[model samples]
Target: MQEKLTINYTNDLHSYFENWPKIAGYLKGNKQKLQDAGETCWLVDIGDHVDRSRPIAEAFRGKANISLLNEAGYDFATIGNNEGITLDYDDLYHLYDEAEFRVAVANLHTKTGKDPSWMEPSWVVETTGGVKVGMIGLTAPFPDFYNLIGWDVQDPMEILKQEIGPLRSSCDVVVLLSHLGIYADRDIAAAFPEIDVIIGGHTHHLLHEGEYVNQCLITTAGKQGFYMGEVEIIWDTEQECITGKHARAIPVADLEDDADTAEQVAVYSENAAKAMHRPAVVLPDPMPCGPYEDSRAMDLLTDYLRRWTKADLAFLNAGVLLDSFPAGAVSYMDIHRICPHPINPATVPLTGESLEQIVNAALQPDFVSFPLKGFGFRGKVIGKMIYSGLTFDITGTEAKPVAKNLKIHGRPLDPKKLYTTAMADTFTFGSLLPNIKQAEGKKYFMPEMLRDLLLEAFQEIEK
Candidate 1:
C-alpha cells in the first residue's frame, strides 16, 4: 500500500507581514484537511522570517515574528543570515525563547561551544503508519558577522556531512531545511544522495514544480509570502522505501485572510508605534537633506562613522540618510524612519589610487543614483558620497562635482600609500565600489547600525 506525507513550507518571509494573513489562512486550511484525512503533515519554515527593515520586527526584536510563527504552527525552522547577523547576541540568543516550534540549525553554535537549548541537529518524526522522517536544518555561514556576534556558524557542508549519516540510518526518509540558497541546495542534492527532499531559501528562488537532482527533490517558495511550497512524498510501506515525490509552489494572493492574524498584526503595529515613540535626541534645527545634496545630517553621520571605527577618514553615501531630522525632540521612530538599514560600519585599508578611483566613480551621476536592492541596503539609491576627516576641491559645475585637490588631514593624497577608511559595509560586497570590494583588510563593526550611530551623533551635536 502507498502512504503519503505532506510537507508545507515557507521561506524568506522577511517580516513582510502584509501577505502573512493569507499565508496563515491557507496553511491552516490545508493542514486541517490533511490531518482530517489521517495523513502526516508538517509545517516548516526555511528561515529569514524576521527582518529588521519592518517596524514591527525592529520594535519587538523578532519576538513578534516568533509569535506569528507560533500561531501559524511551524513545526521546524532554520536560520537565515538576516536572523543570525542582523540581531545582537542577546537578542538572537533569546529570539526563540517563546517559540512553540523547534529550531534545528546544526551549524550554529555559541561562543562557549554549546548549542542553545532550543536548537537540535536533527529531529525524527514518526507517522501513524510507522514511517520515520528525519529532518535536518542548515544555515549559510557568515563567519565575519557571526563570530563578532558571539556565535560560530560552522561550514554547512561539513555540518551536513557529520549529521546526515546518522539521520539516514535512523529514518525512512531524510529532509533538509536549508537556508543556504538554491545553488547550495542543488549542490547538496548532487553531493548527498541520502537527502530525499531539500526545501531551500535565502536566494528567494521559486521552483514551481521542484527540481530533481539525482534522487533528491529540491523546492523553494521564493521570498515573502507570495507563494507557499508544498511537497508530497509517496511511501511504499510494504517495500519500506519512498516511491515518488511531487512539489508545488502555490500562490496565496487569492486566499482568504485569517482574521485572527490580521488583528494580531494590527496590535503589533500599534504596540510598535508606541514603543518607537520614545525620545532618542533633541536637535537644535531641522537638518535639511536629500540624496544628491550635502546635508548636516549626512556629514555628522560620516563623522560619527570615522570616530566610531577609529579610521583616519570616512566616506558614506548621502542616501543612507533617508530623510531630514526635524528640530526639537527626535524620537527613535524618527531616526528609524530616516536611516532604517541594518547596515554596519566597516573600516577597510585602501590604497590612495583606489580611493581616488572610488571617489571619482561615486561622483558620476549614474553611480550615485544607482538603485541598489541587496547587500544590507534598505535605501533606494547609492546617492552622493559624503566624506569626513578628508577634503577635496570640486572643479566641475554644480550639477556634477569633479574631484580635484584630494587631501587627507591637509596633506595631498599619495597614490602608493594605503589608508584606513571607514564606510558602510554595503560597499564591501557587490560591484558598487570595486576598490572597497577588493580591499585586503576589512573590519566590520556590527550590532550597531548606522541609525544607532546617528543617535549617538545627534546626542553629541546636541551637547
Candidate 2:
C-alpha cells in the first residue's frame, strides 16, 4: 500500500518565542488534520531552540525550551552549534533529559559518559502504514570548544559514512537533521545520495521551496521562529521504498497566535524573571558602558579577562557590554541584560608583529564600529577596543587618529617575540581579525562567557 509521512520541522529558533504561539498553532492544527486523513505526521525541531540570550532560556538553562517542544508535540530533533557549544557540559548533558522528542545527533560524543542517554546515533521512525524512515543528526564541528568542554565532536562526513550505509539498509527513507549550514548540506547531498532529505540550519539561509541537489532534497526555515519547514514523503510500504519527496517553508507571521502557548510563554518569562532576580552585587558607584565612548566597565572587564586567562595582554570589544549599571543592587538578570552574548574568552599566541597588526586593525574607526553578527556576538557593533596591560600613543587628533608608539610589557613590540593575546573568541572566526583568525592552536575558555566575567568582577568588587 502507498502511504504519506509528513514531517513538520523548525530550525534556528534562537529562543525567539514571540512567533512560537502561531508556530505551535500551525503545527498542532495541521498535525491533527493530517492524522485525520489517515496520514502520518511528526513535529520536529532542528535545534538552536535554546539561546542563552533569552531570559527564559538563561534562567531555566534550556529546560523551558524543551518544555515548549514537548507542548508542541515534537517527535524528532537534532543539535545545533548554539545548542551544542553555548552550554556547559552539565547543562548540555541534562538539556534533553525532559524532552518529549527523540534526539538523534550522530556526531556528538561525551567523555563524561559511556554515552549520553538522551542522544541516539540515529533514530528510525515508523509511520502508520509501517514505512520506516531513518533519521541521522549532525552538528557543526567545533573541536576546540568541544574539546575544552570534554566533548568529542566527530566529523559529520565521517560519522555519516559510518552511519548512512547501515541506516539505509534498515529503513525505507533516510533523512538528515543537520545543523551544519547550507554549504555543508550541499556537500553532504553530493556525497550521500542515499539521504532522501536534509533538514538544515546554522547559517540561517532561507529556503522558500527547498533546494534539490544530487538527487537529494534540502530544506531550512532560517533563523528565529519566522518560518516552519514541512516535508512530505510518498512511500511504498510493500516495496519498502520512497517514491517522492517534497518540502516547503511556511510563513507564520500573520497566523493567529495560540492563546494557550502565548500564555505559557508569558508565564515562563515571569518565572525566569523571578528566578534571576537574586542580587549579584550592590554597586557602590554606577559603572558606565557604551560602544563608542570610553567604558570603565570594559576596562575592568578586559583586566579581568587577562586575569582569568592569565594572558600577558588582553583586549575586548566595548559593545559586548550593552548598557550601564546604576548605583544599586544589581541582579544576575541585570548582568545578562547588559551583556547577553554567549561569547567565550579565548587566547591566541601571536608574535609582536601579529599583535600589532591585530591592534592596528582593531583601532580603525570603521573596524570598531562594524555591525558584527554571529560568532557568538549579540551586540549592535564591534565597538571600541578596550585593552589591559597594553598602552599606545596616537599620532594624530580626532581628524584621523593613527595608532602608534604601541607598547606592551613596558617595551616596544618585537617582531619575532611571541605574545599571548587574550580576547573574545568572537574575533577568531571569519574575517574579523585576520591575524587572530589565522592563528593556530588558539585556546578557548569554554562555558564562561563575558557576562560571567562581568558578574564575577562585580562580586569581587563587593568584597
lDDT of 1 by residue, 1-463 (tens): 9899999999999899999999998888888889999988889989999999889999999999999999988888888888999999989888988989989898989998766688887899897688999999999998988999899889999988888999999999999999999999999999999999999999989999999999999999888899989999999988999999999999988899999999999999999999999998999999988998899999889998899889989999998888877899999899988898889999999988888888888888888889988787888998989999888987787567689889998999999999999998999987888888888878888788998998999999899
Candidate 2, residue 125: Cα displacement in angstroms equals 1.9
The per-residue C-alpha lDDT of model 1 at residue 373 equals 84
Once fitted onto the true fold, the runs of candidate 2 whose alpha carbons sit more than 4 angstroms away are 236-241, 396-400
Model 2, residue 181: C-alpha shift (Å): 0.7
- How many clashes in each candidate? 0, 0
Candidate 1 clash pair list: none
Candidate 1 whole-model C-alpha lDDT, 0 to 1: 0.91
lDDT of 2 by residue, 1-463 (tens): 7898899999999999999999999999999999999889999898899899989999988999999999988999998888888888889989999988899998989986676789998978788988788999999999999988889999999998898999999987899999999999999999998899999999999999899997899999888989999999898767767788899999998999989999999999999999998898888889888898777788778999999899989999899988899998999999999899889999999998888787777778788789998988889999999899888887766645777877886888777988888999988899988888888879988889999998887777777
- Poorest 10 consecutive residues by lDDT, candidate 2: 394-403
Off by over 4 Å in 1: 394-402
